[model samples]
Target chain A: MLNLRPCTLTWLVLVSLTLMALAIGQAGLAGWGILALLLVSTFVKTWLVAEYFMGLRRVALRWRLIMAAYLVLVLSGIALAWWLAARAAA
Target chain B: MIWIFIYAELLVFGILFLAYAFARSRNVVLFNASQLELNRTAGAVNTLVLITSSYFVVRAVAAIRADRAEACARWLLAAVGLGGVFVVVKLSEFAAKSAAGIGLSTNTFYMFYWSMTFFHFMHVLLGMVILLAVWWKARQGAYSASEHTGVETGASYWHMVDLVWIILFPLVYVMR
Candidate 1:
């Protein structure tokens, strides 16, 4: 029988996401589109770490939202910074 | 208390990351060029190493939850071993850069690269130490199914370390 726990499953997803990000980097593609994908991948991976690995999934709602907000704020800030830079360049 | 510490640590890293992004925006060309010089393979591999270590830590927690102290200790040891691998790989990366005459003063990108990564590297070392302490207690059968707060606390801290790297890898090495 093949049984997998939540942590094991989370690890599998995390590894897959890491590999995907690596592929994106190696492809040498650049644009807002590519950046978006990378940022999204990052968002998912970090969220997984927070939820599954950190055991925040069973925590109080306030704590979980705090982590969620941290991810959103940081990632959105990154996106904004890049957008501003791109606009300035153009 | 650990959660409070975790939040504080997250805040610190969050500021550093925002600073990096802001600086990159001001000098996208320089940042992009310098990023290209980084060994993405090494960064990717380190990402794998840390993530695997986090998985091991998770296993350690699970083992303790089952009242399996020996298994928990062994799992923590495994995680710590992987942490050593991370240290070795990172040292080699730093050594390679040093051999190339790179330092914090190399440029703006390098300054951030060295400072941020070295800072995180220290945290990895601390996390290893913390895990080792927890493993020692576990080996003595200190944790039980009903009371394994120490294991969870240490595991939480280690996961925080891994979480930061998950962001760092893409932010520094992969994203341009």
Candidate 2:
């Protein structure tokens, strides 16, 4: 049940690309929204890589949680910095 | 042990990411302006290349698990070929940046850019070496469905490299 088909991984890659393009294209539209979108997209893409491509899906739940938390910690720091910088600029 | 190494590598990069955020917060305007000078398209392309290569690696592992030694070698070779493309594309991107007089001392952002990406570039080279070794062993029929830890170990390391780039691309390129 934890199998990640190659086709599924390919689709995830394309979805990530689309998210990247959207984030880039809409960067100037709304600063906070763009930052949030980019960070969320980053977290999602990373989860896909870890769970599917890296075969973490077949591993224990604890390991998956650790990976998820690590990603969140890093991205949250970045999102905070982005928000702070925006506030300072404003 | 490989998992330990992977986690350690992730920890190092995580610290760097935090440091980047701290630095960027101090000089938001300069960071944003310097980020503009980057070639997002190149960054995005590298992202695609690495992700596709990672997929190729998954296929290689799958081939080995299915006891297809020749197919496994072919998949690993293809992955290495794509990794070569990543090297070329990254080098070109770096050359273009250098041509514009950018370096580690250029600014805070460029400093992080050069350090993080070059660090990752080295890892890519190392991953390719591991994959090459796996490919050689695979060619010699060294792995079977029940005895493919070598392939799994190498694939795991390569995926770590891919995972880093997945976050690095948007964090550095598109998240301005």
Candidate 3:
């Protein structure tokens, strides 16, 4: 991450998670939990990779703002999904 | 050029991850079972291989910039060598799993085990291609300190591969 293109790595991780979810979704709740955990893992990985690989810290203010906004959208979506699921279960 | 492209690549992967998450939420047991299909020892070795390759690429770029073509080539070869080990181990693992009746159709877990790994294996192949291209470029004096952007970019991407493997080793094989 301290080196170059982290987004590339993030993409790889994301693909891995996606495949895992697709392949394992037929299993049950444990599968769901694992998938959720894997997504969260990918989210963190993507952030770190973007920051370190893309040098977002060193980039211009506008680009940084864009990146930050994108991340917020991601986290918010995740929160919303979990919240909705909980509410439904309740 | 490389940076922006890499970023776009991440976006593609990011969407895929989101899709996977949504799918998993609909079913959890299969995912856990699939995770078990992963071999711990192989994952560890692959992680080590990626880390070693990343180090070699870093050193290779540095050496090339210093006009030490032989050293640069040597490091590049080392990286390629380790990457080769990774591929071989991965394929053999596939064979072992199949012999164990753990084929892709065995369960949800096996499907993921194969899909994710095969996808990753393709990337490793791409990385090796990049290394080969760089090797030729270096031999022809195409990269010096100021003109080694290709090598630098490739190395950076290579390290990201290592990082992914590090996270994956723990997440898929260990955490369960």
**What does candidate 2's lDDT look like per residue over B135-174, in tens digits?**
9999998999999999999999999998898888777776
Tens digit per residue, CA lDDT, model 1, B61-139:
9899999999999999999999999999999999999999999999999999999999999999999999999999998
Q: RMSD in angstroms, all models?
A: 1.0, 2.6, 7.4
The best candidate by DockQ is 1
TM-score of chain B only, all predictions?
Answer: 0.98, 0.98, 0.85
Q: Pick the winner on DockQ between candidates 1 and 3.
A: 1
- lDDT, candidate 1, A1-90, per-residue tens: 769888899899999999988888887778889889889989999999989999999888999999999999999999999998998999
Tens-digit per-residue lDDT, A1-21, candidate 2: 658676465547655664565
Candidate 2 clash pair list:
none
Q: Which CAPRI tier for candidate 3?
A: incorrect
State candidate 1's DockQ.
0.85
> Could you give the candidate ranking by DockQ, starting with the highest?
1, 2, 3
DockQ of each: 0.85, 0.55, 0.09
Worst 10 residues of 1 chain B by lDDT: B167-176
Worst lDDT run of 10 residues, candidate 3 chain A, spans A22-31
TM-scores, all models, native as reference: 0.98, 0.93, 0.67
